[model samples]
Target: MSEKVSLLTARIIDNRRVAPAHFLMTVRLPLSFATPFPGQFVMIRNDECDGPLLARPLSVYGFQRQQDHAVMDLLYRVVGQGTSLFSRMIPGEELCFFGPLGKGFSIPTGVKKVLLVAGGVGVAPLIFLLHKRLLPADGKGIMETIFYLGARTAELLTGLERLCGFCDLKICTDDGSRGYHGPVTGLLKHDIGGFDAGDTVIYACGPKPMVRAMGNLLQDAPFHCQVSLEERMACGLGACLGCAVAVRTGEGKTDYRRVCQDGPVFDLRDIVFASPAGP
Candidate 1:
């Protein structure tokens, strides 16, 4: 929550389908809105429509400041009623939004290598972290950056074109229709040994099963790792107490933290994953 949260109305600049069921919506905000950091999210809802009463949480896919305004991109899949309403939205439509809420990723000081792992639409924030914060103008940075992306098939993968110009990109598919056969984690497991663990850090986001598998896979690894958790939220603020997650505290005690406020991003080791796999 380093950035101040504000409730404002943004006009839709563009909203179009990027993949089969995924859509990328671009909105224009006033210059007074606070800039968002990578991994931060916004709660957005179309006030004029008869959709779900509560606003849905969406990750900030991209953001850029213009001379008089700021443009933001939100990438989402059409999964249910609320999103269906959003898909029908046209340009010039106004949407109510509250954000850049929750804690975001913090790159470790002097880290020599960075790894980003994403599944499905989760690539949104990771792509933002790469271009907006990680890569330099010369297309090189002090740290060696690599991105590992995975999806059910090639068609479901988003942000591949944008990622190629920024870092080393590795892709995988579950159906063997893309770069590597099997899960994206399989690729990471194969290449992880090449890096110095002490100088490396990993950031990830995806479905619950994928995230759980990632945690279990890297539990004993020496590299520092952080993950963004996807959870249902009511109030983007901490007031509702609906997005609480169990976590291991420093004292070895279990405690509850609100995902909406305490984090959307947290140390992978601190999270208590109840299931062996799956949500």
Candidate 2:
């Protein structure tokens, strides 16, 4: 932590329901704080105490850094208490947060093609990546970016409207409410051929199962794939070690690594997804 952690006094800029079960909120961070990178998360507190137990970790959706002004956008789903509070925040209300925490998505320096995969709320972080890195310098980018977004319905898919300025986007909703009537991976399989395998990269963030599914889909592909891993977190820091993930090692073994510290973003090949036993 910095001696004086930049106390960003963020006000709820806009709170709107984008999907049946999803919401998007924009918060204006203090101008002094640095802009956050894609795949980075923020620890939000509904109240300044332990009552809420722990800060809810959320991916940074996108940010705007203007003359002495910084604003961060968040795409959240109301799945729990912390997020519920986030959904209810009024436009003028204030909230406390700590972040730009954890490592973020890595964009290849000379990559000629990029594929961004998003699942539900997982789309949050990718928005930041596309806006800052993929957009053209003079308002048009050098690389071709293809966005693959998946959801059950058109309403479940959020945030693509803004990305139209940067990439060629494709949508897939299971219920046939939007573009393609199938999983986003379906689009990847058909469209991925347009780019060179060696020169392309895939950055994904979403539910655990989807990440695993994506891993399976890209197993034989030559392109590099990185998936953002989500774990049940207590302390957004490494102190708790509650967010450990199993990683494959060079010795043909597996070891546990902290998700909060070692990564929130990881190379797809590094993770070992084991099946859970139960009913």
C-alpha TM-score for every candidate? 0.96, 0.91
- Count clashing pairs, candidate 1: 0
Q: Pick by TM-score: which candidate is best?
A: 1
Instruction: Tell me the TM-score of model 2.
Output: 0.91
Regions of model 2 farther than 4 Å from truth: 1-9, 48-51, 275-279
| CA-lDDT, candidates in order | 0.89, 0.80
Give the Cα-based TM-score of candidate 1 against the true structure.
Answer: 0.96
Q: 140 in model 2: Cα distance from truth in Å?
A: 1.3
Tell me the RMSD of model 2 versus the true structure: 2.9
Model 1 ranges with Cα > 4 A deviation:
275-279
Error of 2 at 35 (Å): 1.6
